[model samples]
Target: MTTEITARDKLLLYVVGMFAFIFFFVQFMLIPALSASDQAAADLAVAQQAQIAMQDTIALSGTNAAAKTESWAALQQANASYYGLLSSSDLDTLVSNLELGHNLAPLSLEISSINTQSLTGYAASDKAEDTAAPGEIDSSDPTLATADTNAVLMELAPPLTRVYASADYFKACTVTFRCTGSDSDFYTMLDDLAGQYPSVQLRSVQIDHAAYTDASGTTTGTATFTVQLSVILCDKESVAS
Candidate 1:
């Protein structure tokens, strides 16, 4: 038998079915969709940050390139200036100019002997000379016997002087020189030589005469001053080597 449905019962069934549909939609579809949208927004933000970082790196690289170019230009200018000065002047002229500028005089100078000792090997000859009143060799009394002997000795020799002539790289050279002038002149000479000649050094300064007064004739004692100087030759190559 079929029972007739009442209006209230029908209304109650409709309300319950509507509630169940709403709950299923919220739990299974709407919440997951909202969560996926939020994750997408976070990923987009990270991508934007990476792009900004990349742009900053590119800008910094450009700045470094500009700085390097400026430094290169400055170095080129400095090298040009140095070369221009070097090309315009000779060694002797530069030295003389420096001396005059520093109020120094190039006094009497001399280069002493340069020597070198080396080991050399020699061979000995086993032939005896018969000096019988100019009769050098007698009739072969059984052919003369010859023997070879090796020997070594120390040889006192002169070094290559031209090698030391280079002003660029001077080797060891002993400069036995004399300078006679006032105290100021002497000191100025020292300064000038040290500044101009990179290979010149003051080894010893022998005071031949100091400031003394000759009072034999006049009552007022007037002093005559002089300085005797000797310099040694020092070269960059010698020091470096």
Candidate 2:
């Protein structure tokens, strides 16, 4: 006996096959495509974040550069304000001013000593240069001959205009002095110096006291104070009124 499928069975088979195909496509192909799209979006977000971070870093670098320039300008300004103090020639002027200030101060001061130095490590370079004989080499210094030769070459070298040429731009001047007085008097002297010279900066201050008994058995003591000041030194070209 031969048997054949009816039309209803064939239609049911067609519908079942369609449903299976749809299920497999969604499970294997469509779902994975959607997952891939989500992953791509996440990666794009991360890339954008990285780009923003780089931009921020660039901005910070520029800001730091500008800040450095401003700091350098401030240094120059400070140096200009101390043009007088930096000069060995100005030593007499300093003493004269101090003498005048002492007379005007509220207390009497006993000034023991006053000294000046260069911030460039060599305190009395100018004095040494003046005292050295022509073509003389300091045998104590191995590099002295080379240094002197370089100095002569530099002096003879033609001046080339440069945007940032400076003579020892990082250098400054230092002044130190010792005085004997009471603490209040010391403060008064400090105030006087600060008032008279705007560029004078107090670097260090120390006080020493000595106590003694006289014939009357009265207790008395004296205080000695030491003070140091710093002032920036600039090239003559940068000097301003």
Candidate 3:
């Protein structure tokens, strides 16, 4: 006996075929496309980071160039203002200029000393002293130990020493002078001197006053001014050559 196909069987076969096609389409096309998209996003992120780093490096280089230019300009200005080594001829000129044109009491100019200390060694010694401990009292001498007394109070403070450059390259000449006169005249002389030599470095100033009391208890005084200054010295001929 032969069996006949039914409409229900045909419809069932079509539904199963449709489900298999849908499954294969998702596995072969949709899944692979999604994976490719994720990989492309990761690659884009890495490229963006690299670009940002390059931009930062370029900016930093520009900043450093600007700083170097500024430093060079400052060095040139300083060199132009500096005076060279002192000489006998220069000394004579300096004295003549001060005495002839200016009006004040009799003043004298003298060279106090020349300092040629190493900057590195001086700074190291200062650091060592700062880190050292205080010394104990001395039993042998009637007075306190020099170290103990010098450690803090009851000791005179040393003058501030400014280090400009290496001892091998430069020397400092200390010039000191005294000016005595009425207060008005004294200050006017100083102002004029400063105006003439604007680059001179004034180190210290000391003033002394002498007053006399008369029968009526009135007092009159004249002031004396001591001024110390520093002049930088170098071998200008050698440097120029």
**Which candidate leads in lDDT?**
3
Candidate 2, residues 20-139: lDDT per residue as tens digits?
A: 999999999999999999999999999999999999999899897777567555655664555532445474357446644554221222222223221222323333654322223233
In order, candidate lDDTs are 0.43, 0.55, 0.57
Candidate closer to the true structure by lDDT (higher is better), 1 or 3: 3
Better of 2 and 3 by lDDT: 3
Candidate 1 local lDDT, residue 203: 47
Off by over 4 Å in 1: 1-7, 56-63, 72-241
Which window of ten consecutive residues has the lowest lDDT sum in model 2?
Answer: 160-169
Candidate 3 vs. truth: CA RMSD? 15.0
- Model 3 TM-score (2 dp): 0.42
Clashes of each: 0, 0, 0
Query: Over the stretch 38-121, how does candidate 3's per-residue lDDT look in tens digits?
Result: 999999999999999999989799897777566545544554565666675675466446644555555777774555533333
Q: What is the lDDT of residue 7 in candidate 3?
A: 94
RMSD each, Å: 26.5, 15.6, 15.0
Model 2 spans > 4 angstroms off: 1-80, 92-96, 103-164, 167-170, 215-217, 235-241
